[model samples]
Target: MERSTPISRRPKAVALTFDDGPDQIWTPRILDVLADYRIHATFMCVGKAVQRNPQMLRRIKDEGHIIGNHTWDHPNLTQLPLSDVQTQVLRTTEEIDRVAGVKTRLFRPPYGDLNDDIVRKVTSLDHEILLWDIDSWDWKGLTGPQVAKNILGHVRDGSIVLQHCAGPTETVKGTLEALPYIIEVLSESGFTFSTIPQLLHLSAYR
Candidate 1:
């Protein structure tokens, strides 16, 4: 379906979303960080990764984070045949449902790449495209300070900030390092961290 508009928007809040995860290594540690701050962020999980670590996905849900699908293999949706694109999404959705016991309508295209046809196909599966407003670029091996600057420099009320905990060690190291500082700074500014559902007032799972 079409992506959601605000049912009611929360003020002075930001949504922290992690993509391509349910990672066995960094995810648990990242979750620990979120727990320490009593924050609930969103995790956009890939199917094969989840298969390797279903328990991690379960942990994500058990701890109250909303889980969204990031496709089976993180393919660019606009480049695939529409049927293949649908399969990529459905397969991941099914895996998430099996592991987490929830069906999420939230779907984020890999690399934020999508076209009208891709959207039509994904919407056919009842998924609402969930893209981010802020990209930390942590995947490119930006330093912790750089990652913090990327987010803090652009953050605003109701912004969706993207970071990843699942990737090469070097790629995620900066993100893990920057997370606490970013969270603390944002919190001190009276900005609350929200999961996507909370920010947008949409159902997290169905």
Candidate 2:
């Protein structure tokens, strides 16, 4: 399936996004890899993870990547009350602001699970909801090469590719291993990596 973003109209552009991060160990490693390629990716961070490693959140910002809210915890917002859903989003947005001094306008629902209520609440808070068209499925115990294959197979111009920076040990390892090849192949194909805000031409922070 082809997914188009407003900014993706540029030829050969794609957004790379990592979910559930600011992890103490893996986040730094992922940053290093991105740095080596001179590319920036968006990180959708859990509020609890950001609180546990605020410095990592700052580092992500300092390094010129975008940080987005992934919720205070990894809850299925579609299953929660509207009030609880609001709390989940706002708390994380506040935590991100408290740590990085910027308010993010991007949100990715946990597990890509959402309903009308979750969308209404997130929209009311002035956030654009982001979901991926190309899933690397690194969380599924695939090898790095396999994950890379999956991503390359499905990606197109204006595609948002999903990978996890924090998860089980194997997931992190596979993502790390797959990233270089993913970058190399995509870059050689004339695809440039972009953050979500950059891709959508939206404000990264309020």
Candidate 3:
């Protein structure tokens, strides 16, 4: 009789991805909080930030977080030329590779916006496109309670959440303050945090 492979069992995991970062102020604080909770996240970084603070990029990689492409300048990708779109993704990926020694195959378009032209260029470069199922509106003027509520309200099995490392106004503080409670409630409800790659592995598209 042939022996069947024992399936590796894993929990229902959710992905938490941050965009427009490696910010000198907030990214480090967010990293510390994630480390304290022993959770991992995916950071979609801008190429210019990577170029300016290679060390922060290195720290992000070293801390076991997944890195992804978020373009050189945060813009509406649907409005940009194909060549410009290609340059944005490729340059960011290359910069991350140069500093972190890891070439990313994942990308999240800025503003969750993409057009056919952008799509063609992204696929041509062989990067997987990431879109969120849940947006916490941390980029807007939502309070910490609102942020936490938005996340907890929409979170579900295999849900991908959109948060940020750049807080929009002086009062927002990057929404890092909401993370602990979010993680706590989610974990209590039997949710496990995973990076985008891990989430993809469990997704039907994979």
Candidate 4:
């Protein structure tokens, strides 16, 4: 039985976002699934991950996926001093620029953890925070079916789904397994997949 929204004729859009990636293993596998589906997504990458896999970051850019700064070490920004927060964002944005020549303006905090100070710091760096409306809970180590159930149960027009490219081994596997089901069910229900920028109609790279 279908788990997504009831079929509608009107056009609707949702975003698929993967975080903490540009890794060798999980990232590529997730990219493969996206490529097979021919859908562009957003990758919110950790700074060190980009440095460790510069070429992977470039490939992600080349493949028409949007990239965002996810911080240097995936710290909770709300817990950091403003100086540290600024450094975290700047370091990652610079790394993305160094690798891909794309000035990404998207930022997503680790664990959806943020506060007013963090928000101000991010915007002061010329980035807009992008959060998800639906979370797959892949990072929590749910199975494929569980991840799929989490997303499909709540996705609707203009939903942004939080997923991950690199996490625990089981997490990535779960996300990978859930992709086909998520994509198919959404498509069947007339929900068009989009990168966050496209879904929000914002300039992706500055």
Give TM-scores for every candidate, taking all chains together and pairing residue i with residue i: 0.95, 0.95, 0.89, 0.93
The clash numbers for all candidates, in the given order, read 1, 0, 0, 0
lDDT of 2 at 42: 97
lDDT of 2: 0.88
For candidate 1, lDDT tens digit of each residue in 56-155? Answer: 9999999999999999998877888988998999999999998889998998998888788998888888988888778998989999999999999988
Worst 10 residues of 4 by lDDT: 1-10
- Candidate 2 residue 48 Cα shift, in angstroms, is 0.2
Candidate 3 on 11-37: residue-level lDDT in tens? 578888888888788889888989999
Ranking by TM-score: 2, 1, 4, 3
Model 1 residue runs over 4 Å out of place are 1-9
Question: lDDT of all the models against the reference?
Answer: 0.88, 0.88, 0.79, 0.86
Off by over 4 Å in 2: 1-8
